[model samples]
Target: MFQKIFRSYINSFSDLRREVWLLAFITFINRAGTMVIPFLSLYLTKSRGFSLEEVGWILTFFGLGSVAGSWVGGKLVDSIGHYKTMTASLLLSAVLFVLLQFPVSFWSICAGIFLVMLVADAFRPAVFVAISAYSKPENRTRSVTLIRLAINLGFSAGPAVGGLIIANSGYSGLFWVDGITCFLAGLLLLKLLHPKKAKENVKEVNLNPQAVLNDKPYLLFIGAMILFGFIFIQYFSTMPLYYSEVHLLPESDIGLLLGINGFLIFLLEMPLIKYMETKNSSALQNVILGTFLVAISFLVLNLTGWIGALLVGMLFMTIGEMIAFPFSNTFALKRAERGKQGSYMALYSIAFSISHIFGHNSGMQLIGEFGFNLTWYIMVFLGVVACALILWLIRILKKEAVSYSSTPIL
Candidate 1:
């Protein structure tokens, strides 16, 4: 049975073998470099010596930069080819990575992180554009899932390696490691995915904002994603602190917890996504249920002290993420017009970047003032709001479905 399933999966990718492998490899390497950033606060405070407020500022700066990058990348993908935009961004990011390794002042570090995020995050929309451009709609969702799997696999390795590097050589080592990996990955993409020029007939599609941003349903979905992102950003910012303060998990154990979360995503996300696909579940329902599970998981974490309990909370959180993310991407792709997939996905990407600018700092401040339990409850409240938005989006989509179905493709 297992062999049969494996064979079936292989058969599904027969046409997309080259594109899938190229994307997978690129995703893995790029994500491996992500390790240097997420753990950056730990590096700053624990190693280079910075305050919590400073960390928040740096993150906020990075977020602001990413917001701009997302927009620019989307537009560039519409105008230029995906390979060109992605290569430029990735190559620039590699240079920025090296700059970040410099033993600079706190202000310099903030500037470096912001610049890197701006340039590096630009690759995100380019990647989504490439996937949409390369694959037929029938295979797009699965292709995205494969890329996500590679991301998780790379992430699993990145943190463990990051932790070990930090433990031995400090934060500088982390940046240097990230720099080397990013440089290598960027070169690989440039060499392998030699992008062709944009076709003239598709130029009209590129001009339509309605294709990406004008629809009511899509806007509603973005609203929901923004709220979801706010709560989710806590995983990086506040969750580690909560573990340290309330649960009394040591620093090493916290790293292990995050590693376990990444590992589970690597192992289970693809299979779970495949299973969900078989069930014909709608995207809206998945978003609602997933956000609910994530919120509930936080509540459980607030009450539990045992490592087992924490792991269980993370399990539920991962489940929620796995369900929501791919479905969200697929839904966005469907909602977008032909050739505007990059713009749509880039708008979706805004959620995380926006969350970083406001979400983490806000949560951290709330925790600083009100305490961990209150902060967790606030996250739950945000999740509830996200659910409401998802439901609203579903209604909007249902209303538009018939109208769109009858309309001629422009």
Candidate 2:
């Protein structure tokens, strides 16, 4: 039975094109080196002696840069194609990451963080466009899930390794490693996905491509995603501080705890996405469910101070993430007409980037002023709001005669 189950799991990942696998592989390399952001707040407070509010302000700059980067990246993809945009963003961001290590003053670090992320996050929209280009429409959601699995797998390794690096060589080590891996990922992409080869693979058909701004249903969907992103980003920002301050966990333990989210997603998400696809469930329905689960995950943290509460909360959050993200991604890609994918994905990436602008800062400020319980409650409330938006969006899509099946809406 175990062997059969394992075979089934393996089968879920089969049938994807080679380019899709290559994309996933390079994403793993890049993300595996992403060790700094998770520990930024901790580094500021423990090492640099910044107050929580100060950390909030710094992260707010990070978000602003991300928002700009995503927008520019999207435009670049539409103009130059995903290949060049991704290559440049990766290489440029690598240099920025290394340069970021030297800034010591509060304002200097804030400027540095903003600059690094501006270049770094440009990769998001480009990669999304690349995924759409690389994968078949039928299995696109699974392809997204596959890339997410790579990201989670990298994340699972990054934090644990980051913790060890910090213990031995300090936070500066994270910057160097992150830079090196990003540079390597760029080189790999250049070598494997040459523009001439990529062009041969993609068959573009412009099907009455609607301007993203005028698509009311999609606009509402973006609004819902913004709320979802706001609540979800806390895991990377303030939640680590929660683990450190309230639970009194050391950095190594905190890294392991954070790693659990990625590990669970890597282990379970692909099979779960495959199962969901078979059910022919609407993406919005899954997103609604995911939003509610995330809300409950935060509420679980309030149930008790026991370490088990943290574990339970992490489990709930990870499941919510596994359910929501890929489907939401697939929905956005499907909603776009072929030629306009870059713009549509850029807006989607921007929604999350906008969340970064407010999500981290608000959580930090709230915790500093009101404590963790209140912040968690606020996140749950926001999650409920996000669900309502998605429900409204579902009604609009239904009115438009959009089918909820896996079929593309072109």
Q: List candidate 2 stretches off by more than 4 Å.
A: 41-54, 104-106, 163-173, 196-204, 240-256, 301-309, 367-374, 403-410
Q: Write the per-residue lDDT of candidate 2 for residues 1-410, one digit (tens) a residue.
A: 99999998899998888888999999998888888877888989998899988987898888889888888888898888899999998899789888887888999999999888888888999999888788887888899999998887887778879999999999889889889999999999998876665564476567676778888888898998999999999998799999999999999988788878877887789899889878756777888888899999999999887899888998899899999999899888877663377888999999988887877778888999999999999999999999998888777777778664445321
Runs off by more than 4 Å, candidate 1: 1-16, 42-49, 163-176, 196-213, 302-308, 402-410
Error of 1 at 50 (Å): 3.8
Model 1 TM-score (2 dp):
0.86
What lDDT does model 2 reach?
A: 0.86
- lDDT tens digits, residue span 1-410, model 1: 99997776555445554766787898899888777875877777877788988877877787888998898888887778678888888778877877787855888887888788888888888887677666655565667878888887887779878988878987778778787788888898877765542231132454535665556667888888898888887887789998888778899999888777777876667767666656656766877888998888888866756667788888888889888787777777666653366677789888778877888778878998999888888889889999998887777666665332232110
Worst 10 residues of 2 by lDDT: 401-410
lDDT value for model 1 = 0.76
After best superposition, candidate 1 residue 351: deviation in angstroms? 1.0
Error of 1 at 232 (Å): 1.8
